[model samples]
Target chain A: MHIDLHPAGTAAALAVLGTEISETIGARVSALNHAVCAAHLVGVIETVPAFASLLVRYDPLLTDYDALCAQLRRLASGLNDEAAAQGRTVEIPVCYGGPYGEDLPFVASHAGLSEEEVIRLHSERPYRIYMLGFLPGFPYLGGLNERLFTPRLQAPRTRSPGGAVGSGGQQAGSCPRESPGGWQLIGRTPLRLFDPDRPLPYAAGDFIRFVPISEREFCALEAKKEGARP
Target chain B: MKILVPGPLTTVQDMGRRAHAAKGYPECGACDKYALALGNLLCGNEEGQAALEMTLSGATVAFEKPALFVLSGAQANATLDDRPVPMHEPVRACAGSTLQIGPFAEGLRGYLCVRGGIAVPPVLGNRSTDLKCHIGGLQGRALRSGDVLPIGPEPSGTTAESLRHAAGILREKPWLLRPRTAHAYLENQVIPLLRAVPGPQQDAFTEEGMRAFFSGLYGVTPDSNRMGIKLSGPSVQTIDGSDILSDGIVEGSVQISANGQPILMLADHQTTGGYAKIATVITPDLSAAAQLRPGQTAAFRAIDVREGVRLCRETAQQLRYIKELTIHA
Candidate 1:
């Protein structure tokens, strides 16, 4: 993983590149964010991590721009080798039809396939969490199967309620808040992807694979997993 | 406290509205964060304490009881019962005394922070008024006449001598909270140099169009508000047309509409946007952009992300040092 250092006002940022978009990359980035955040500096307040970059906010008074940049470069270089290592793959059960996936049929039709076929194709491949942004816990997963690619809505709706699973242009992610979205809404997840009250949600480099289940099984899981650990 | 006469564009504001960028909400808050910080500090309040933010014209406030207060930002001719008051200084006003903030002789916004902060309830973890969402701060709207706001607890260390001395100096002298000389910081109508990083979708624009964006001067239109600043400038041509996916737009994200004009997102902008973003203004220069009034012409300068972060850190450090000096001095 090669990291490009950028100057952002009074802070320095690390743009991690060349690492394959995978779950391991996401985890490594998250770990780096925590490590940097732990180092309390005059200007370094927080670190905002995105698909391939980590924007660290710092105080310019205590640390000069060049010094912070050097620190980030050093830290990023250390993480480069570790990010290349493999990470755990977590499975997420998704009910792909009915109310959970209001637009599943539409997506299936758009992709020239039946709803079951679309689900099968979607569940068949594993996805890498490139970054977590747009909202907390809203992972920007890359490496989607190109066959399931579809264009977003021309005019986005006023709001897409939380947990409303959506897909667009080979990208799939969940919404954390009620927001206007152009992505093709395929399904809803019972899981609360983002809970700011929680310590951490999904991190970068985490691998996620969808396991298709019946609507009945989804309900049972929802009820049984009420108090499940995040 | 009751608003006897609402000043022009007075709204309750705090530090900012955050985490709603994905929903396309601009992080609208105090336009002059430096002033707001001073006001809060003078009143011994927390950093994100709530206050009434007024623009150009000042509001007339009548107190229900004696309270400790400070006014910062724009230089508005303020008075208590027709007697001239001071700006950027803490003052103690008695119950039933009417405090009026007149029209601004210069600058745009002024912050009035009372001791203990504003008593209004917060929405979405913020008390900052979001004009677009019409939520938070005085019923999510601008201040109006006859609006009575409940005051919080009375402040300690508020005395007649401190109020008189602070107010006298502030009214007679220029603001001491000016930026350091290292930066080419401009005041009033003078626009600062805006540095930006190429947007994620910048490649969608033609190379010529990208060059035009950096070289061109854009005037902020009157249609601009907390949500976005509409700019009149050279039209930018995109190779793939105006189609793009709706995604998160942070504060300072410059979005081009179908008509080809750029709209610079501001504090109250929505979390996500579909318009093609060509550049994102660095965070340090955000305050400079916020102070811009209508008709101000601004130019975008491309800077590497490292430079942008360096500038931000430098500015923040200066502000922190000044804050410490002011408190101790």
Candidate 2:
């Protein structure tokens, strides 16, 4: 595999693995990211793995672009698929078709299916967390059923509550916080996707499995979380 | 110190949460690093120590103990007990004294650095306020009225004599501490020119689009925030539309949206974005870009990586010069 280095900025560089978007590209990107972090290169701050590239942020005073690029190319050559398979499958509890998911009916109608089928299809399999972006702890997931694909809302709500399980086009993920979003919301989770005190339970290469829960269970878990907080 | 009146948006910031971008946390910090570092240096605090970043307007604070503080970035009419506090200089605040920092007369953001940095418990290794995630800095939100912030213990080796001497200088001759160079906004230029290098996705844009980006005068939109500075101007036509497979983003990325408007990513920008970026504002010019307020216009000029690195080094040298000047004075 060959890596192409592009200047993201003065302090950062994007190591493009390939142009085409696929699981192979993502796995290679993940491997390079893991390898870079393990190497502990001087001045390297962090590595963010996306669909087709790995963004390496570093300090220019300690390391320059050419040096970092040469190092990145060496790491990319020996990448293995084991890094892709190492991610844990985190099960997330979700309550479907309620106040938390106001767009459930719309999504169901758009997909020509009942609300029950929608939930079953969404919760059937584990989806890969391709990357986290747009917001802190917000996962960009893949592996959604094509039959369940629904268009995003034309006018997104000004504030969508955190833990919102949403789908737009072929993608599906949870909103980590209360922010404006256009995704077709079909369910909600009580768990906090993002908490500063708690290390993010999931990462870029992890898989997220949605577990269907009743509204009562959702409230109980929600209250338990609130009570746990000081 | 107690906040009597929290301005429009004020948050505690440091150099930002480094090494956390991989987990999708924003590098939230002072929009203008030079200003924050200058204030911190003046107050004898570590360069990356936490300070208060006030946007548009400044806060009114009441100190419960004697403290040494400095105001920098965006000229603000600040006073301690109604006596004017000079910008970029350390001044003393007596116990029970109320200091009011008026709205910025120039630029958009200001930094308030006390000798001991703001001592909010760090989250993810940073004291910065991540407003969206509700993490770090005063419970991950802006300062509110009556909010009492803890000041960190003074750095070791700081003696009472040094504090007294430093505090006395402001009263004796405040102008001695002022930097001779004025802020770029204070200059007579109608539009600030930001130097940038071609971005990773420069090939995605058509020749006309690149021309528009370089030649166009873009006005900063009110919708701009710490996340990104949205600009409106001549439409930058693209080759295959502006959308790209989401890729990693960095501060100062000039992304052109489907509508052809440019959005300059800032400190709080997301880790990744889908729009095509045509250029990245150089490190030295990022502070200048950050200082641009809504309704102001800015132009972009292209430079190579060699020049960008040189400019970055020059800025560091300038900071060192300021630190030495302050020490001798």
Candidate 3:
């Protein structure tokens, strides 16, 4: 793996893998990120990996840019693409249409297809997780079918609750918490993407496949989730 | 300490959850970390000890145990059992005493640091509250009325009796151990000149746009919060637009929106952003950035990255000096 270092701020640096936004680059970035964290170098704090770059924050007082770059470069050389390319694919049970998915009718009408067709196309294939950002546990997924492409809401909703499965532009993901958003909601997930009591279910480089479920199944899963919580 | 009145917004914060940023967690901590450190040092606690960060309005509390505490950051009109308690100096509180802290007279946030720190269960290896994700510190929420805050055990050497003695001696002279740098001059009334260094996306903005950012005066909008400081100023012209592929964002990043205005990312800002960044406020000036209130005006002055790092070292030295002065001779 090869990487280029750029100054992010006074105390942080951005390690760029490549300018291209692809699953290959995301895998390479994730591999290097994991390696850097595992090394536990002094002065290094944490790292956030995006589509094609990883931001590494550190303390300048303990280590300067030159010393830190040498350490990162050394770690990058030891990373293999195979280690990060393969990640566990998690199945998310989603309930499509009706009140759970407020904009499903609109999306189906805009795409010149029936509501069932839209759901079938969306759940037909698994999407690659490029990164998790914007909000906590909010996965940025890639490879959305062009047939389902739709613009965001003209005016964003004031509050959208967690477990909201939505799509915007070319990306699709779930809202991990109640927040103001402009995504077009097409479904709702039964599982919590982010829970304070549980570890984050997904991360960058992982794949998520949506499995369509009936509204009754959604309710049953929701009840089980609540019952499991303390 | 037991909270009698929870005030407007109060949360426990330390140095923040720095390790969880990679996992989509914002590094939520005290907006003004320098002030938090000062309060901790004054109370003879570790610099990163968890303290109650009260914003705008302050909380009214009753001490269930005798402890030495210090109030830092914004200046507040506080009374302990109806007796005035001075800022920047250690004040011993007896058990059952009521401490009423009024709205801040200056600055935006104030920190209350007890010797042992606020003993809240740590979430994700941090006590700082992340309100958006609902995790960490006091059940992942702000302190409310009737909340009972437990204090951790005091460290060696800073016993209740020793603290009582130190408070008495320090109150006599006051000036000897008082760290003037600990005080944020947020009430100066004049527009603060914030120092910044060019960000990675500096080339995305035109020369004229860069000039507008450095020369123009920006007003702090009311929409500003811990997430980011929204600024209203002259439109900064971009090469195409301010939109870019979403990238990692750090505190102090000056991201120009598609509307041409700038938003300074703060402690609770998102881990990644898509707006084009023109510059980043230096680490030393972040305290000043955190103190800027709504309706106030601020200007930016460009500096090199070397100078920015140098200022950070200088701030660290100043904190060490204060630490040495506060230690009993």
Candidate 4:
């Protein structure tokens, strides 16, 4: 609901208030990050939001640890109010099952559901972007329905092709780049979540809802976007 | 211009890789960032300029044209044209002079910086060589014999007059780039107490396991590299045997594998890891950790997130002061 400010060095520590590790954590972290970033220019060089924590890299020369911690605390405590003032949402499209989702069967079986049911459960809920990490523009989506919860494969693939949709535990998201991953892939999204060349990538509080589409619709959207990108 | 013979482990490095840790890539850059800074300062280059990172053994390079260079870091028996050359000081070499680096007497890593920085293509916003992907640096591998490297245009005002002026300032006053001040704690085996802030997975380890981590002595294993350091010490047990989903890991993260041995992730570590990270070393001590050899012993000291932040700020101030002195000098 709010951010918790802890005393850090001369700087103040800013963390997501609750410890209940849930799907909405990323959005909350992202909201807090935007607030803190907008407030302090020198103390905050970068903010790295993880599953449960945000690592803030600051310039010590300009600000001492105590001063920074104080600033972080002040900023974090005000995040909820700031987020309420400016709200935005983003929608994502996905093609579940079939070729895009090779491991659909495995995930369905693991979660004790049929393939169709798995897709229904996955696309039914609106997910929150908990954080952006693991790669450039990689979004960590939270709020996967418990019925869809599944463990990752014991041995990870050497490389998971970029844009492969995957799920693990109660979380699911697509890979932004080819990398070794252990998440159980279920479907793929047509959207490119991260493009370094793009001005604004996915932000933390942005909403991601999977709009199920057929192969034809996916191809049409891809073509339209490609034509527009000249 | 060409590598006569590649020494043991030489690679192109800058200050450190950053903003890419979320993807499982460790900030793999120079083992000694301060030394790299000094090399750059001596050559009147920017802080993050690329330079050759030489390990215990030195490398031999044949220059096609005269170059302004500076050697810093571990004291190495370096020679040019069969004559011994001074280190930590700028030197000018003729076109045909062969620079040969011999065995190091004190430290493990050395840095050789040219006037205009290395001319390698930048990858992912950096020119530092990552040994894992075998990308970056000279053809993504250690420098070897017969490798012709292209030297960029030298910096303006790097003439004898300017160098003499810089040298005069350094000689007249106690320079902030003094390697001894930063490395004083490293002389004896009394490793500086490393402070670590607990991570999200710290709760997974048993209280005793955590205690053992702080109280027990851990030796850096021979397998340690840019990716991670394999620490050998007491076996640590976690609260649950269940595995965790892969998540982002950062430089200085101490990830405990299923086997109970702790692996301290370093620069060039994978962006993400499945193992539970109990703690993350504060950024200030990371440089010291980077310089640790395989046989070195390190002790971990637990500090709260607040204290860790304080240490980071103080260290940053120290570095800034050093940089300011360099500019003024």
How do the candidates score on chain B by TM-score? 0.85, 0.91, 0.92, 0.86
Backbone atom clashes (below 3 Å) for every candidate: 52, 0, 0, 27
lDDT at residue A97 of model 4 (Cα atoms): 78
Q: Which one wins by TM-score: 1 or 4?
A: 4
lDDT of each: 0.68, 0.83, 0.83, 0.69
lDDT of 1 by residue, A125-203 (tens): 7777655555545667776777789988888888887667768777877675566888888776656554433434445
Ranking by DockQ: 2, 3, 4, 1
Candidate 4 runs further than 4 Å off = A1-16, A81-99, A109-114, A189-200, A211-230, B1-9, B17-27, B102-105, B121-125, B130-153, B156-215, B234-262, B269-284, B300-329
* Candidate 1, position B253, lDDT: 79
Span of 10 residues, lowest total lDDT, candidate 4 chain B: B175-184
Better of 1 and 2 by lDDT: 2
Residue-wise C-alpha lDDT for candidate 1, range B1-329, written one tens digit per residue: 99999877889999886544322234678766767876776665654688998876889999898887888777779998888876666677899999989888766677788888888887767888877556778888998899988767755544445544544444454434433212333465444567777764676699988988887878889888777778898998898775554444566778888887888877676655556778878766666676667777787888776666566656566555544533444
Task: Please give, for residues B1-329, the per-residue lDDT of candidate 4 as tens digits.
Answer: 67787788888898666655443334678877777877776776776789988877888998889988888877888888998877766788899999998978866678888888888887667788877655667766777888887666777534555654565565565444433222224555576466676664776799999898877778888888777779998888899952565545656778898988889876677665567777777666666676677787777877776666566655555555544544455
Q: How big is the positional error of residue B208 in model 2, measured in Å on the Cα after superposition?
A: 2.6
For residues B32-127, could you state the per-residue lDDT of candidate 2 as single tens digits?
888888788777777789999999999999999998898988889998998998787678889999989999999998999998899999898789
**lDDT per residue, candidate 3, B1-329, as tens digits?**
89999888899899888877767888899988888987887788888899999988788999998988999888889999999998877788899999999999988889999988998988877899887778888988999888898899877644444444555555575543322222213555566778887876887899999999998889999999988999999999999998777878999999999999999988899999888889988777787788878998888888777777777887777677556555643
For residue B282, give model 1's deviation from the true position in Å.
6.9
Ranked candidates, highest lDDT first: 2, 3, 4, 1
Candidate 1 chain B lDDT trough over 10 residues, lowest sum:
B176-185
Looking at model 2 chain B, report the run of 10 residues with the lowest lDDT sum.
Answer: B175-184
